[model samples]
Target: MTFHTHHHEQVAEELYDIFESSFDEIFVTDAHGTVIMVNSACEQYYGLSKSDFVGKHVRELEEQGIFYPSASLQVIESKQALEIVQKTDKSRYLHVRARPIFYKNGKLKSVISYSRDLTDLMELSHQVDKMEQQIEFYKRELVQTQSDITGIIVHSDKMKKVFQFIERVSVVDTTILILGETGVGKSRIARLMHDRSSRKTKPYYEVNCAALPETLIEAELFGYEGGAFTGGLKQGKKGLIEKANCGTLFLDEVGELSLSAQSKLLHVLQEKKVRPIGGTKEIKLDIRIVAATNQPLEEMVKKGTFRRDLYYRLNVIPLYIPPLRERREEIIPLVHHFLTVFNERYNRNVEFSPKVFEAFLKGEWPGNIREIENMVERLVVTSERIVTIRDVPFLQQETYTSAHLSLHQKLEELECRLIQEAYEEFGSSYKVAEELGISQSSAIRKIQKYTRGIE
Candidate 1:
């Protein structure tokens, strides 16, 4: 327990040298798994210095809930080795493997665990999940915007949370249901959830249940064996469920599935087994089910347009992605992200004039990220530089002020609207003015003049 012993010091020095070189934490724990020696790397990893971790229990510093104490304890008492996730106050997921040491008499002495922080991986998984949701959202928005599908953008906190939700669920093996409006990105979230899960490295197969012919739905999902059904492949075809083995299967518009398909899909999900069309034996496949729908499934189930049992099965982790209108705060970022994307695609640098962004905030992005992406793409293809609000035909033609107001008093109402919006958006006069393409002093004067009556 002293600072050093000559023999242990020599060995500890070598270990410290190794620890200093390592990016991960490496510390020595005593027989009780309490910190006996701390390395600089270990300290830095835990946001502490050597002096602080000298006496703390290693397990206490990690998330005990993530581990099975009995299994971890066995590694120390029986000289076993085990790997697990370590959750701590500072970090959520750390890849740790504990290796135990034994005496000549076969008695266990102490255990050493190498722990690597993987919070970034979890975050990355989350990002992939987010993008997945965004992409799907963009797809629906693409159709809704009546804008170009090649161009899509998402900039909304609501959409970002959708992404975060997808990321959180990527690693989990469970059935996920994505719900939103017609133009919302449910399918994209499904792909995202798949790409970030344990199955990310595997294939992602997608099919739209609504689009498939009702008669062929079963064959497409479960595949048919040669001679099993008339006109079936001679060699037999692998179903979408089978094709998604060890990966993710995205069933879009699940609400549209026929009762037969729903029954089959539900069985596949529950049993983790698939049957080929006309095949006698059921085949097992490793699959993650990601289902999506724009329909109000619960309402439909109540009305008997959709199945109640299938609804419950797919709703294990229900993700309700809010529409673009809710997260207007993300409009600018989404615009920029889309602008950059289109700029690269078309080799054009399209700049947004002050009015364009103002117009963006004013306009409703019901199509969500997809609509923005299309508009940005249009700018890329049609215009070159200084893409102004006028360049957007929608902005030029659309009515900005409330439609209920008469034209005569609308200007005064519009001025009030702009000032109020700027104040709320910027939280300060200077920021609003910058966004509004005005001087801070002018912005202050305007606010002073306009609010004088109310104040």
Candidate 2:
């Protein structure tokens, strides 16, 4: 009996030495799911000391997402050995194996679990998947013609259909009305239509009807004779429609046109000719009209704000563009695209962290493509080697609030802050315009408005 007791102690000491020396985590729990003992390796694997894990219930730890699937619990239930991969709360991967110990009467006794960290291997596999996706992206890019939407990225099925629509209508000289929410790439789609058309070699002009003041919209669209207005040019200049003769005229925000201006535009679309404001002779035109607007023109037509005849003329080939949030699949590709573009433009090599990508995928993107472009450019220009969620505080909150204000007032305040900072950083309206995706003229106007008292 004395010899047998000494042998059992020696065997227990050897097992304890093995448990302490083992590189992989060794966790033991009783049949009741209570942790009995854990090795020092738990500290490195889970950022917890042996004391933190010992005496704790395995069920509690599993619920806390320490390491999911609770292998010890599974072994206890099955009364057999089990092996499987598990995920920790920190997104780490582990290859775990658990074995059950049985009593002399075949009742459950204890369960021992061994886990090896597989986080590095899992990360490497994810990288390979990303590389494969990149390869597929490059292949799709190669399939597209450079002249077709030069800088646009179309990966979603909805956008692919939009591209197909552009191709079919490009050969025809029909008027197309592009309807979409703001910043949904209506302008770029118009450009793609012009590029794919027979009018590719001719002049292409984009006129932002909303940006042009109501007082000047008519004169700008239909030209003015010399001395037609107080500050007119000495020599009468051809209006955008006349300038775009034999080509395409993209009237952006066409819903903003005044009633009288809409009348004149309808005449031009019907007669294919324009007469200067103070001139007697009329000039013929052979232009393709492509109009885009975020406003509900049909509703405006019912309200008599927009002309009915003009709406019918412009809506001949109506093309609706889905907003970015509706096409979530395209978000990542666009992020990669904008990152590449801004990196090249700014001579910096910056990348978004995985968390940033996740956030982008889950974002609402109220401003659509323009918002993403601006955000990616801002990150590329301002971030270090990697851009994380910390770089975008606006994502955490809907709007900046310093006082009680209406939504419009809040937006104006935000715009004022952005314009001010952009002006300070770039020191030029053109750069600020480019940074904010607005026109240089608009940028100048805003800079004057927002930076009125700044030194």
Candidate 2 residue-wise lDDT, 296-371, digit = tens: 9989999999999999999999999999998886676677666766787699998654446656777899999888
Instruction: Give the local distance difference test score of model 1.
Output: 0.66
Per-residue error for 167 in candidate 2, Å, reads 0.8
lDDT of 2 at 340: 63
Residues 1-455 of candidate 1 have per-residue lDDT tens digits of 56457779889889768867877666567667676765565665566678766786644432122221222343655556755444444523355667777788877666666766655643454465458648866644423222222222334566667777767888889888888775555665675576567776687788889887998888888888888877777898888889989888888888888877888887887788988877789988778888888888889999987778888889999889787677765565556556665676578876664346556756777786677777777788888476644467885544657688788668876776577545533335667688889998887777655533121
Among all candidates shown, the one with the greatest lDDT: 2
Candidate 2: pairs in clash: none
**Stretches > 4 Å off in candidate 2:** 1-150, 397-455
Residue ranges of candidate 1 with Cα displaced over 4 Å: 1-164, 228-232, 397-455
Error of 2 at 133 (Å): 22
Clashes of each: 15, 0
Worst 10-residue stretch by lDDT in candidate 2? Answer: 142-151
